[model samples]
Target: MRKIIASLFISLDGVVEAPDQWHFPYFNDEMGAAVDATLGRTDTLLLGRKTYDGFAGAWPEREAAGGEDAGFAKKLGDARKVVVSGQDLSFTWRNSERLEGGLVDGVAALKREPGGDIAMSGSVSVVRELLAHGLLDELHLMVHPIALCKGMRLFEEGEATMPLRLLSSTTFRTGVLHLVYALAESAGDATYDDAKVHLPQDEA
Candidate 1:
């Protein structure tokens, strides 16, 4: 089964919206390599409508312009993109297709297909939905050290609690934390009392 990996550039306050407004100041070679590694494993791009629209508008143009980012742009343009939207869309970008049915069913079907891992970026809603439905296999977060204070967060109030187990963590020179997580098989039964034995003698 192909894994559905969701990558996001998030702020210290858990904001995942509009990273373009606050993400670049911390960009470094370490972060670049981390992102490159994620892209290296991705064969298909699963995108929400908003993210798809942004990419479809900019990437094709960037690919044609032929600049430093053009290579990455071309790579994005070449990938098979599946856009999730309730409304019908006319995709002009090559190798783009609309998700056929409900988000859960469509995505579950995609996971069963034989291919390399499916990757998603900047699709906050899609990521939340996938994670909520147990369809997301791994979540890779590049957590910048700044707090946006006001924006959509990966987890919001009234949302169901999700327990994730850390698979790996890397701290970049820029202070951005690259965290990889997978859903926990169980929300462990440990409580505060279970940690009492480890308390410092003075504190106890």
Candidate 2:
């Protein structure tokens, strides 16, 4: 079975929105390499309607222009993209297709396929649903140093408490922490907070 891995850019206040505003400044070669590793591992992409529209608008043209992210842009453009949407998508980007049924059942079917892994990023709605259904196999959070104070959080109010086991933690010089977690079998033992492996704050 293919694993469903979600990688997200998040802020200190648990805000997952508009990572481009504050998240980009902290990015470096190390971060790029980390992102490369994740992208390399997954052959398929699972996106919600919003993220699908957003990325299709960006990556295809970017690849055509032979820009900075052209390689990755082309990679995404060429990869098989499965979008979770209610209405039928008229025109998606290259090699894209829409799943025209229930999100949970459709995605669950995708997981049963023979593949390396399926990658999802920045699709908070879909991520929440996947997490709730225990469909997500690996969760990678790229925690930035700054706090937005207000934004759509990764974990929202009235969200159920889902315990996770800490898998690994890697800190960059740019103060971005890469935290990996797996869904824990026993809440009495492992918790998500147990995954916080902190590093020294950069004194400037």
Candidate 3:
């Protein structure tokens, strides 16, 4: 089964909101390389409605001369997009689908499909839901040097204890630390037999 992975670009304090205070300040060679590398590995994408709109509006207009990242944005625009939202809105992007069945169910279905790894980008709400449901297999977080006192978070409020193992970490020239983590197996409840649990692989 393919793993469900989430790639989030966060601040040092875990803020995942609009990093670029203005429209064009966040683009740099390091960021471009990072974005390019991440996009090349994955073909499927999951996004929140707001983020979907954000990319839909910006990437299509970005010219190739903007930078390597703009070229990457064009590549992202060509990939298949699945947007999870309950609000009724029109999507004009090619090869895009609206996930109206709710985040948890939609993701579960996506996990069952036979395809390349699914990457979640800039969708904290969807990411939080997947984390809460124990549906995520890996998390790739790029923690930037800056910290925003107030912004959206990468995780949600909940009581479920999530154990993670750091698979790898790397620091870029721009001071962004890329941390990769896998959800650790449950240490409690020795009686939990995974085979007899009767959960679908996708649901698991």
Candidate 4:
């Protein structure tokens, strides 16, 4: 089975929202190049209901404009999209499908598919559900330097713990730290703190 990967730009305090307010400079050459590089790696995008709505409203038009993010946005517009939603949702974008069941079951079905990997952007709730079930394979965290005092976080309360092994780490001159981790089978011998990774306090 292909790995399920989640990549997000997060803050020091674990906030994953509005990175542009902190580290993201708008549409610079480096940002464009990074967007292009990430798009080349995957063709499947998974999202929550809210992220689906947000992206659906933006990417299609951005693709049409033929602007800076246009090429990558067009690829995303054409990529297979799976949205985990409790409510009924119809998307204008082609190749988009809604997961009309509970998030866990929906993701399990997705994981059974034959593909390279399923990629997630702003699907924190869905990520949490997958992590709790130990269904995710990889996490690509782009840790930005600034700490937002308040924002939506990648982790919330009342979630089970799962252990991860650090696969790689890289630091960019822009002050973004990239940490890639893979899910590991729990040995059940080590102390919980030593074995499991916890989210930052603002994430709670």
Candidate 5:
């Protein structure tokens, strides 16, 4: 099955919305490389309507302008983009389509199809739904050092708890932490005593 991976830029306070306002300052060569690595493995782009609209509106123009970002814009324009939206939408962007049927069922079907990894970005609702249904395979969070205090968050109150295991972590020079995580197979039954093994002991 093709893995569904989500890459999100989040603040220390867990805000995932409006990254454009606070995310760029920490973007550096290392962060660019990490994003490129994710895109390298992705063949399809799964996104929510808002995110889809934002990219569709900007990337094509960027590609047409033919500048430093043009290459990346072209890459996005060429990818198969699947947008999750219930409202009727005309996807004018190249290779773009609206997801058919229910979100969960549609995405589940997509995963079973033969393809490279499906990559998602800036779709908090879609990401949350996938995580709730145990559909998201990997989650890559670029945790910035700032606190937005007010914005949409990746995880909100009254939601069921989900367990995740850290796959890898890297800190960029700009203080952004690139943390990769996968859904844990099981929430381990370790207790405080089990964790005590790692504590430093005083010499007798």
Candidate 6:
């Protein structure tokens, strides 16, 4: 099964909304490379309606003078896109699809298909639902060195406790931290034979 990987840009205070307001200052060569690496791993882009609108509006008309930005825009334009929305609006991007059915069921079915790993970015709401449904496979966060202190946080209050295991951590030259994590094995979901729980017959 293909994995659903989510990459989020969050502040020190956990604010993920409106990254444009505070994300550019922390971006550097290392961070750009990290983004490239992520794009190389996936051909499908999963986005919420808001994020999709933002990206679709910008990436198509963006022009760069021979840099990673140009390349990234091109890659984003070429990648297959699926938006989480109730409206079946006409998508201007190529190879775009809509998830009008229930969100969890639609995304789960997409994961079951044989394809490149699905990647999501800037879709906080969709990512939240994915986590709540236990459908997200991997999470990569670029933690910037600032605090919005009032925007939408990635881990909002009243959400279930999600346990994750740290896979790797890398700090960029610009003080941006790239951290990757996967779901940890929950105690209840952990497989252990009850018969093997007995103490061994050894000298004590």
Off by over 4 Å in 4: 26-40, 186-204
> Which residue pairs show backbone clashes in model 1?
none
RMSD of 2: 6.4
Clashes by residue pair, model 4: none
Q: What is the C-alpha lDDT profile of model 6 across 1-204, one tens digit per residue?
A: 999989989899899988888899888889878887876457998998989999888877773445546767888888889999988779887778897467989998999888889998878888888888889988999999997879889997887788888999999988888999888866454335755667486778
Q: List the residue pairs that clash in candidate 5.
A: none
**Which should have the higher TM-score, number 3 or number 5?**
5
| Candidate 1 structure quality by residue, lDDT tens digits, 1-204 | 999988899999999988988999999889877877776446799999999999898989988999988888877888899999999899899999999878999999998999988989889988988999999999999999998899999998999789899999999998999999999877768889998979878745
At residue 18, give the lDDT of candidate 2. Answer: 79
TM-score of each: 0.95, 0.89, 0.78, 0.82, 0.94, 0.86
- Per-residue alpha-carbon lDDT of model 4 for 27-107, expressed as tens digits? 345544554555445778888888888888898999899997787787898789888877777778889998745777777
- Best lDDT among the predictions, by candidate number: 5
| Candidate 1 lDDT for residue 120 | 91
lDDT of 2 by residue, 1-204 (tens): 889889999998899997878888889998898887777456799998898889988888989999888998878887788998989777658778987558889988998888878999889999999999999999999999988999899998898888898899999999999999888875566455665546455779
Best-performing candidate as measured by TM-score: 1
The number of residue pairs in model 1 that clash at the backbone is 0
Point out where model 2 deviates above 4 Å. Answer: 189-204
Candidate 5 lDDT for residue 114: 93
In model 3, residue pairs whose N, Cα or C atoms come closer than 3 Å (at least 3 residues apart or on different chains), thus clashing, are: none
lDDT per residue (tens digit) for residues 146-186 in model 5: 99999889999999889999999999999999999998867
Ranking the candidates on TM-score from highest down gives 1, 5, 2, 6, 4, 3
**In candidate 5, residue 119 scores what lDDT?**
93
